[model samples]
Target chain A: MEYIFHITILISIYGILALAQNLVMGSAGLLTIAGAAFYGIGAYTAAILATAFGFNIFTTLIIAPIVAGLIALGIGISFARFRDDYFLLATLGFLMIFNTVVRNWENVTGGSFGIAGIPKPHIFSLTFDTPFSFLVLALIVLFIVIGICYFISRSSFGRVLNAIREDEDALKIFGYKTSTYKLMVFVIGAMLSSLGGVLLASYITFIDANLFTVNESILLWAMIILGGIAKNRGALLGALLLITIPEALRFFGFPNEIAGLMRQCIYGLLLVFLMLYRPKGILGQYKL
Target chain B: MKNILETKELIKSFGGVHAVDHLSVNIQEGQITGLVGPNGSGKTTLINLLSGFSLHDGGSVFFGGAERKKITPWENQIYNITRTFQQIKLFDQMSVLDNILVIITERNPFLALFERHSKYHISQAEDILKQVDLFEKRFHNAGELSYGQKKLLEIGRVLAMDTKIILFDEPFAGLFPEIIKKIENIIKALKQEGKTIVLVEHNMNIIRNLCDHLIVMDAGKLLAEGHPEKVLTERVVLEAYLGE
Candidate 1:
């Protein structure tokens, strides 16, 4: 039961990340790969604040996303002119820069060793210290993220975002400042992904630079692609399946030494088959 | 008739070649003005300049009798000027209704995030779809429409903007005669509603049947301008543009 709760907590955290990413990648047609960078920013922010200043989880939660959002605003403005592959490349560069900073900034980020002794979330008398309780907190955050994605997907703002994906120049001709919309969604997605980071840091009660690498960003992308892009349920479904699949591989009795390698092989093969047969994803309405 | 849009010595160039060279033209209010020229004659470039899709290299544009220094496509729409592309450009992935809704919905991003499409907005979009005879395909993706239907949807989008001056670049190109007739009626209706129109086309029959005023160009310069019948009969226009 504890193990099940652990898996569920991880799924919920990733579910938040995937939904936020869908706003940029699916709705706006921006192929950003810097999700993990924002996630790291949030995690590091929460870790440092809670440890150094003895701030509570509630305070860190609010501050972390704001920190990530401000950074995203700067990046979005600087990279506003890039489109398609260039945008993707720019985001990948940002991810590398972030990774370098966290790994090398010894005093603040603790270099490669990273911060430790992070506290679990608590609200006055209540504490989310156990796996089940943490799972409950993660689920609540995931639901809030889901609600935001759903609201944006149904509004007029979402209509413009869909139009931006389809044809940005056409939308501009109709009097939309496409750049502003792009920047807004980028910041919003960053802030939400940061929320996921905060939860991960607090739940693990430890922090390390290795946890928020570019590979983790790629995993988030795979979740959205495998589950479906643009659909909220698809994002959640993706988070659920991708998290469970590797764990399920553990039960197959593969050699412990080759288990990690075999998991990678299976993941690669599944994605290949998905791309070949279901290019739009399992429930996707739009193709990248 | 008053000039709704006037360009004074407008110039746009690409590398060494001039696409619109010191071109000056007038668009009369509440009239259909045809821009007829051969290929490479800068008709579309001129439309691009007027609609703020491209910037001028030199000279000034006057809208509502006020000289404008700078403009963007969105700013132009806010100034009550809009356009349709020669190639149909709709939100292909969106529903036909959404193509219109996007234009008619809130312009404010914050308000738009929380506000659902009001009854008036949906009804307005429905009216536009009905106008273009695409009401049956309201829920269909814009990309799934036939070429003629796409053209009509583009026009429907223009109508949804509710702008005063509209520039159309080869709207009748690659369209069937029946679709052409539908577009002609829509343009005529727009004119009747007091909208100023500038049309670019290669079809002489369309120019003769629909245009109240005409401007002819050759090599980025105005060759002739006046009543359609008068300009079409000019010896220079016939020899240079009509191949007579």
Candidate 2:
């Protein structure tokens, strides 16, 4: 029962991250691997504030997104000069730089050792000490993110993003400096992903550099692409599938020695099979 | 009475061949100017340079009769100088109404964050769609439109920009004659409203019938310039097209 709640919480947290990923890749037509970096930024920012400055989870929840947003703004503005693959490369650069900071900044981030014993979230007299309570909190955040994504997908700003995705040059000639829009939305996606990061550290009660890396970024991309792109419901379905399928394999109770390896092989195979058969995934509209 | 746009010795080249060599021309405000030339004579190149899609190797484009400055393609969105491509470019993923509505967006990106298209914007879109005969298909995805419909939608997008100077690059090339007639009326209406248009076309009939002034080019140099009827009759133009 507790295990099911834990999986539900994981889905809710990652569901938000996948939605953030969808905003950049699915709507804005940007393929990036930098989401993990901002996610880490949010986690570490929360971790540092909680342990060092004695800030509570709620305070860090609000502050961490802003911190991550600021970092993305600086990086996004500088990298906005690059387009297509170069922009993708720049996102990779940001990922590496962020990972290095978390790993080497031993005093602040605890370096490779990581910050552990992250305090679970609490508001007023209510405490999210159990998996079920935290799942409720996580669901609230997920719904908020969903509402915002729904609003964005229907708004005029969303249409502009759709335009940016389909025909950037046409949008530019019509008097919109597309690079500026790209930067703005990149920052917004980063901020939203950071919220997921905040939910992550508090729920897992542990933090580390290894948890946020380029590999994890790729995993998030796979989630969105597998479920779908541009659609918020796709984000939910993606997070559910990617989170539960591996845990379901564990229910088989395979040998501990080969279990991890076998799980990885099956997971990789599933992605390949999905790509071959349902290239658009279950709900994806975009191929990439 | 004053020239709205003047190019002084504008030069562009590809590898070693000059595409537009020391070319100079002036366009009066509130009139339709026809730019005609044989293939590769640089009509499209001039449009590119003026609209900031491509940079010229040398010379300057003096607009509003003064202030010679370098034109940056990305930053020229505010210049109200816009163009349509030789090949029609529209936001194919958006609805035809959205294709027009996106440009009519609030200049303020902040306000546009949550703003749905207001009644004013919708009505404006409707007006342009009706003008281009795409009102019936406003909700359809632009990519699903027929080729002729795509051209009309592209022109509608240009109209939505409300730009002072519109560069139409071969807008009528692949259009059906019936659609061409519609575009002809639209152009005539634009001219009547005093919007300056530089039409790059290969159709001599369009040039002769619609253009108030005409400039002809050959091998990256001006071959003739005057009223359309007089310029089309030039022996040099006939030879430029037919070859000596």
Candidate 3:
């Protein structure tokens, strides 16, 4: 039961990351890499608020998304001026900058060692310290996030984002401010990513700059690309499958070093082949 | 009549080559003005500058008698100024009905998140589709439409904007005669509604029939301007088109 709960919590956390990545890359058509930055920001925000200010975990959870959202909004505004590969490059720069800031800001973020002793959320006298209890919290948050994403996907705003992907020029002539819409999605996606970070920190009771590294950002993108770029089912499926791959391989009894190497090779092959053959991803609406 | 849009020495260049060089023009309200030029004559470049696609290097553009510089394509829609692309720009993945409905529906981001296409928005979309004779293909994906149909869908998309000034950049290109007639009627209806229409078309027959005033451009400069008959007959215009 504890093991099952652990898997559930991990899936829910990464599932949110994948969904947020989908909104920017899939919906808004902005190929950005600043996602991990926001995620880390949320984790650190929650950690600092809970530890230093002695705030309630629930309040920290709520405040963390807002802090991450402001950072995303600022970066999105500057990045909106660029397009194509340039925009992607700008976001990559932002991710690196965020990581560096988190690392060097030892006083606030606890530096490279990261903030530890993040207390679990409590309901009256009940503490959600165990994996089983955390799983319940994670699953509830997952449903709420998924519900919100599902609603947005079917809404008129979703159509605009899709339309932007189809033809931004067309959306503009149709009296839509495509850039503003893109920025909004960027911030929202960032907030969602950070919410995942908040849960991740709470679940593990620790977080560091390494947790939100650029490699993790790429991993989130890979999950979205593999699952299906634009579809909701795709995000969830991608998160589950990608997260379980290494564990599933563990049954072979290979050494950790060889397993890690094989995992990297598999990820590389999947990404390359997916791009070359199935650009639309497993469940994408549009073909690559 | 007061000029609705006027350009004062508007200039734009591409890699040191002047595209719209010292171009000064005025578009009066409620008139269909034709902008004609051979390839690279800066007809589209002028449109780009006016629509805020390309920034002007110098000069000012006054819309409704206010000086505004470097407007965004989306913000220009709020000023009741909208344009169609030379390449038909429709949401290809979306149905033709959605292509039009996305325009007329609430553009607010928050509202967009909560609201699906309301029945009223769909009805309005269908009305525009019917006007363009595309009601039968309303459910078809816009990309599946033929070149002519795509052009018409783009026109339908713009019509939903209900703008005061509509710029058609090469609207007649790649269109069949029947589609051309359909568009001509749509432009006519827009004109009848007292909307300012600026057309950059090569088809002289349509220009002669539809354009109340015409401006000829050649080599990024204004060649001539007047009624289509007068401007088409100008020796300089003839020379610009059919050079010795």
Q: What are the TM-scores, per candidate, against the unseen true structure? A: 0.97, 0.94, 0.94
Candidate 3, which segments miss by more than 4 Å at Cα? none
Order by DockQ, highest first: 1, 3, 2
Model 3 Cα lDDT, one tens digit per residue, B81-198: 8888997777887788888878887788878888888788988999999988899999999989999988888788778888999999999998788889989999999999999999
Highest DockQ against the true fold, candidate: 1
lDDT of residue A26 for candidate 1: 87
TM-score, chain A only, candidate 2, equals 0.95
lDDT of 1 by residue, A69-114 (tens): 9999999999999999999999999999999999999999999999
- DockQ (Cα-based) for each candidate: 0.78, 0.59, 0.65
> What DockQ class does candidate 2 belong to?
medium
The parts of candidate 1 lying over 4 Å away from their true place are none
Place model 1 in a CAPRI quality band: medium
Candidate 1 chain A weakest ten by summed lDDT? A262-271
Could you list the iRMS of every candidate?
Answer: 1.0, 2.1, 1.5
lDDT per residue, candidate 3, A118-149, as tens digits?
88998789988888888888888888889879
Taking all chains together, the TM-score of candidate 2 against the true structure is: 0.94
On residues B13-70, what C-alpha lDDT tens digit does candidate 1 reach at each position?
9999999989999899999999988899999889888877888899889998898877
